[model samples]
Target chain A: MADKPLILAVDHNRRNLELMSQFLGQEGYEIIAAASLEEFDQVLGKQADIKLALVDIAGFDRSVWERCERLRAENIPFIIISPRQSAAIQQAGLAHGARGVLVKPLAVKELLGLIRSLLGE
Target chain B: MSEKRLPTGIPGLDEVLQGGFIPGRAYLARGGPGTGKTTLGLHFLTAGAANGEKALFITLGEPEAMIRQNAERMGFDLSNVAFLDLSPTPEFFAQVETYDIFSPAEVEREPTTRKIVEQVEKLQPSRVFIDAMTQFRYLAADPFQYRKQVLSFLRFLVERGTTVLFTSEGSAEAPDADLQFLSDGVIDLEYAPEGRILAVTKFRGSDFLSGRHSMRLGERGMEVFPRLVPEVYRREFALEVISSGVPELDELLHGGLERGTITIITGPSGVGKTTLGLQFMKEAAGRGERSVVYTFEEGVETLVGRCEAINIPVHAMMERGTLEVVKVEPLRYTPDEFARLVRREVEEEGSHIVMIDSIAGYRLSLRGEDLVSHLHALCKYLSNMGVTTLLINEVEYITGEFRATEVGISYLADNIIFLRFLEMRGELHKAIGVLKKRLSDFEKTLREFQITRYGVKVGAPLTGLRGILSGTPELIE
Candidate 1:
């Protein structure tokens, strides 16, 4: 039997990370939750088998885009979660090699579909 | 004890509710902002706490500390009352984490429900007060769910032997009609042009006073003044006629005013209307009966001075504890409030004669209410209590077409004694006549009336003058 796919979820809000881990973990994925830049870097440095990532950029400053760039260099497909819909953040996500830019209050079905298609399931 | 009623801890409101609320039922106090809904809730819980019953105050709007401070200012002792403070804390805003995957109704309702149930089960309070029950509307998924949850919540309290009083902050966007239907009774408080009014719109198992009653929120807290219902109060008294101290004036009345009848002293300004009412009070004082004069138009000192000058001996009557002169500030009281004062005088102090000095001043106090109806209710209440009532009406026209009474309130009077400025022998003089006496016959002829320094004087019937009713008499034969 093959092990489940591993998904990295990053958000400043503890509750939002808890919600994501509970929801996506039920979908046959093992989730690694991080609440700060240090935790995100530590997980990405050692874990090269990461399948996908969901990054909520609410409390993080401008340095969060560099994390998105690092995910791109590591050949990991990821989605950026913006608190509001703005052309600047969408363009930044595109520049940083994000597969999609989802707004805060991500639609549950839409998020699941995006992850499944990225993982080829 | 299980079938006893609950006092609402408000003065005069229990009487309006006809001996307080029935136990083990939910009631709604519906009103807008600043209408004393929260104060009323505090009154309920405090009253229960005073009786050594467990009382719970579930505040959903104001925090418990602020509520306690306010209640302390109003002299409410809340030591025994338990408070379930469900109001939002400052940390709710200071926290950086926010979640929207699930709606607030889904995320918060279960925990809040658990908290309330735990508190109630732990305290076992017999009295419960929920401030702003409409706050639950946000916790329910929809209006249907809200209604179902509130109904069950209230039933849960009632099944546990708790009498509940909840308040709803009704607005145009969200009215509390559903809550009104859910509760066993509804008390509505509102602000009208006259003053703050409280009305019991619905009571399921009890009979309540059903009208707009006057309510005041003052420094001491809320006080309700029930509308006077004449038919509810009655006493069996003799129908004997009383005598005026002046013999000729009593002859004009055929004897004097009846014991329980209302007499209207209608006249022009300065035509001795108040003086005649005072004369009757003097006679009642001589008989050792107490009299009260609600002088809306005159100062107490001025009335005492004028009565003493005309030999009515108001000072002596007051000294003897048989007379009371109340100077009423018209704008300071609503008509219902004034009626309460008069009720205390007649029913509590045993006053036999009650006089409202002038109708116009009383009308001014009404401040756009239905003057005739309020006056009728007051007079009927006084009459039913077997007390003599004198209503002084000042007509605007001094010497016109001879109207019996102005302001269209003559029908409320059982006896009409009108005074006029008559032109007799090219001299302006006062004449008195009885237009109608409901209980007995009165003299048909007018009499020469005068107010001398000594006392009120009346001459024999002037049959020699015809057309005296016209305000200008002509001698015949």
Candidate 2:
């Protein structure tokens, strides 16, 4: 059997985090949840083999950008998630080194497809 | 009696206050953290500076650099504004001692307020902002003495024609009601579970907006929004027919939704309330008009997927900035925060149509606590903005009388469109009716509806039905 991809989802909204975790978990992915940048750092320190991350832009602070920049330097892939799907925000996310931007209440199938493409699945 | 006015420079705010703040008078801005008090003070002074008036911002607790950084993020160029930082020093202590002549121990403990006043005097600014007054409370052992000192400092500013905006951290019961009373005006910022709300607790000698209004701190600064009043709304805007996105439903609504008015779509569980709301959003977005959907029940992706099934292309509209979808669980937010989020979409995105998918979900998420007032405030706020608001309300069952829970929302709404499941010939059928529309004449008929791949379609009316409200109607065969 193929190894389960470790997916990290960061969001301050607990309900959203839980929903995303459940949805992704049902699809054979190991979901790691981080509520804030502080918790995200702790998770990153412990879980060294995270294949991808879906960071909620609403919960994102300035620190998240710096962390994403560091992740880019280390060749780790991350996607920006937001309820707002404005072109300006999408462009800004791309400029910040995000592989893609997922507009929220995400399409599970589309998100999965994007993740698979990014992971070369 | 003519009063001096201080312009906040925020367009709507200036208009609401009949030009601006009472000139040469001190105002107290009190709120907890993230309440936009600091932002308002900054905007006040920065706005003054923009108008060629010298403004000074004195920092007592936070570092000057931190304030500058925050301002930069909000797009406030504070370079022209004077910054006086009084962190720790004998001079700060001496100023504290002078201000705390009534309470020496308080002065010896925290000297920020006194130093703030000294800086104000030195700068001789046309406008002044004391970042906060919370730190000063610790200086006084007695609350009475603290109030006295605050009054003295405010008097000093008023005497010099320096319009001062003093920010403090606390709710109404913040042990500084006396101080608030002493100020010429008191602007209270509150973070409710729904959204960020700002209230003018007291604006002396002026007919200011009295009740709490929704506001948000955005790229421009503090944007003060006016509350919606349905009675006034009926006076200003004309009502036009709006499509329910279902052809049958459109016929039921007498050719469509009443335009430039409020519409309430009330239904029971699994009655396709959200689907109906989404259809309206889709139609509005399709027309190239901006529409925003706030769903407490569905996620943005789920909503998008549903839209895709209905062939609505919501993501394309969102990318074009013509459509915005926000999923807000009431449990995850206060009333004030929710209002702020709505304000951001309305102001920043210029959304003309807004849909709240099921107020029942919002009520359930909030656990039915003070939601009615919040809704009332929100409805009033949206109506005043002339934004056509569609509020989806979920009823437990269609049998009960058509009345809003406690908040009396039906009375507050400019229009009410009731959705229900009526059983015809022992088979369940969707039905809709226009209960009330304030301005326009709408057909009073219970029309049948169907949920199809395209969206809701309003079929012909169910003839020969008296107990339609009971959900069991005998249709003419």
Highest lDDT: give the candidate number: 1
Go through the candidates in order and give each one's DockQ: 0.30, 0.01
Tens-place lDDT digits, model 1, residues B209-242: 9999999998778999999899999999989998
List the per-model TM-score of the A chain: 0.97, 0.91
Model 1 spans with C-alpha error above 4 angstroms = A1-9, A18-32, A44-121, B1-3
Expressed as tens digits, the lDDT of each residue in B149-240 for candidate 2 is 77777787779988888887765556667767778888888887556777877877798755666676778787776554334333244545
What TM-scores do the predictions have? 0.86, 0.57
Fnat, 2 decimals, each candidate:
0.41, 0.00
Docking class of 1: acceptable
TM-score of 1: 0.86
Q: What is candidate 1's CA lDDT for residue B163?
A: 95
